[model samples]
Target: MFSDRLGAAAQAIQAQFKHTLGQLDDVPVVRAMRHATHGGKRLRGFLVIESARLHGISSAQSIWAATAVEALHAYSLVHDDLPCMDDDDLRRGKPTVHRKWDEATAVLAGDALQTLAFELVTRSEASPEPAVRAELALRLARASGAEGMVLGQALDIAAETAEAPLSLDDITRLQHGKTGALIEWSATAGAVLAQADAAPLLRYARALGLAFQIADDVLDVTGDSATVGKAVGKDASAGKATFVSLLGLEAARRRAADLVSEACDSLEGYGAEAETLKEAARFVVTRAH
Candidate 1:
């Protein structure tokens, strides 16, 4: 059921992106934009639309938020795969944006994508209320900016050079910003749109996001590059600390399962309406790629 919804979300966002990008002039940068945003699980976007549905928000309005999150996520992946960053170049089973094009084009495409995220979210058609649009844009900026995802990336880079490997707590903090922050925002987007209490979804997202990363760490150890759609085993090769490294394989898997349970429990307030989200939590940990 979740897989079907996820696939539908991916298709919806792709159509939204294609239509939005069609307004731009035909050029290499535009091409790069299309390339970078082409494919993904679209989990973040799915969370946005699902959360909105739970809140009785219209899909038409919520889709803009969903697309915005996906765009920002794609931008992050493009920059993260740059020569100066993680370097080795594969994403979503294809060449990383920098490798597919050039580094300069990749950089510009990422920048434009980031800006376009805000443009999509703030459009009057998706969200007519100025305050709601502002809140979404503001929260997105914080989640993706220095204090959130960028901070996590910076810490990750620093860890590579640190004398000692990061502690478990350190990695948790890092992943919270890098991975968890955006998920939290995505999951809470409907609550934000509706001006409703978001505490439950926020709590659910925190657990789900951590479980997702733990699964990533586990996959890094057990997954093949072809199946995972990116270079696998880089963490061990780099000697970076990860949940798998710190807790051992079985323990890491156990921890992810526990987090998934917690994430599902956090949705109790939403009753049967949140069953799909609960399934999503389980899927995050069980997915092979």
Candidate 2:
């Protein structure tokens, strides 16, 4: 059921992408934007939709925020795969934006997507109340800007040249900013829209985000590039410290499981209505990509 819901959400997100991008001028940069945002698990958007559903928010209103987060995520991935960054050639089993186009086109596409995220979230359709739209945009800016994902990314790049490998605590802190921040925002967006308390969902996201990152670390160690839809074993090849490298594969798996349990437990207040989110937490650790 969760898988079906996730798939449905992914479709909705892709359609929204098509509708939004179709309105833009048809050019190389716009095409690059479409290419970069084409496909993924759409887990972040699913989180936004599911959380919105839990709050009795209609999909019509919530889809804007959901699509906005996905656009932001796509922008991050495009930049992350640039030659100045990860220098990856593949993403979602296709040539990355820079590899498919040029680095300048990729950069412009990423920038456009980033701005589009704000445009989507701030649109009147996303929320009737100006306050709610403002809150969503504000939180999104924080999550994706220097204090959040960007901070984590900067730290990660710095780690590559550091004399010493990052410690477990350092890695955890880094991931909290880079990955956990946006996840927290997505999970809490519904509550923000409804003016409900977000504490429980926030707790759920914190654990889920860490588990998600650990699972990614595991995938890097064990997944094939084709299966992963990107380069695998890059972390190991770079001699970067990851959960797997630090805790060993079995221990890292155990830790992710524990985090998933914690994430599920945080939804106790929502009872059976939270089952989809709980299932999502479980899926995080078990997913191949």
Candidate 3:
């Protein structure tokens, strides 16, 4: 079904990035790049591709957009693994950038990658309009900056010291800041690129982001390294706020399903062009990882 196509696209995009990373001369940089790039469903890139398709945009344009998203995603993961962040030793089943290299090197590498992502978008062949490309870059910046990902990470660090139990709303807000904002942009950036105007797309992406976060929480509770490519139950062990922690597993799972249904319904006007996005909604809730 959609899994096969989605998986193929994800795998292909990762491979392309891996090839690019191989050309770098620095060992630590190479290792960090390789570690960050390995193993994942390139969901953000898929969103860009599918969103573009919905507006009759070609795959050629989507490829470059996908590449930029992938680069930005890798940069985020590398930083997330640093001692200042998640402080992890593994990502996608391999040693994290900080583990593979020194912390300073990992940090610099991530910083470089972040800038490179913007560069990618600026020079992307798929970008038919520089202004639009810049706008998309701004979207990514907003999604990944203090207003979005960084703020969420800060809250995550803050929660580590709080004595009180996390409320459901607390969990939701954290995820909305962390995972949901990025995901919402990832889904809608394509629509933005396609020049497709619709209020429902925004609504769909918002719900889709929440659904994606809930599903991640479910997977963290229920998945394993083999399927997830990262440690399972890490959230619980880290005492991080999650839907499953506040809503209960059953409730979180139900919410995820509901969000997916709503997301899919939002694309009713798109017909077959939105099949990838429709299937993506299902994949979000159903994914093992």
Candidate 1, 103-189: lDDT as tens digits:
999999999999999999999976779999999999999999998999999999999999999999999999999999999999999
Clashing pairs in 3: none
Put the candidates in TM-score order, highest first: 2, 1, 3
Ranking the candidates on lDDT from highest down gives 2, 1, 3
Clashes of each: 0, 0, 0
lDDT, each prediction? 0.94, 0.96, 0.78
Per-model TM values vs. the true structure: 0.99, 0.99, 0.92
Error of 2 at 139 (Å): 0.5
Is candidate 1 or 2 superior in lDDT?
Answer: 2
Q: After superposition, how far is residue 12 of candidate 2 from its true place, in Å?
A: 0.5
Q: Which stretches in model 2 have alpha-carbon errors above 4 Å?
A: none
What is the overall TM-score of model 1 with all chains considered together? Answer: 0.99
Report how far off residue 110 is in candidate 2 (Å). Answer: 0.2
Best by lDDT: 2
Global CA lDDT of candidate 2, please? 0.96
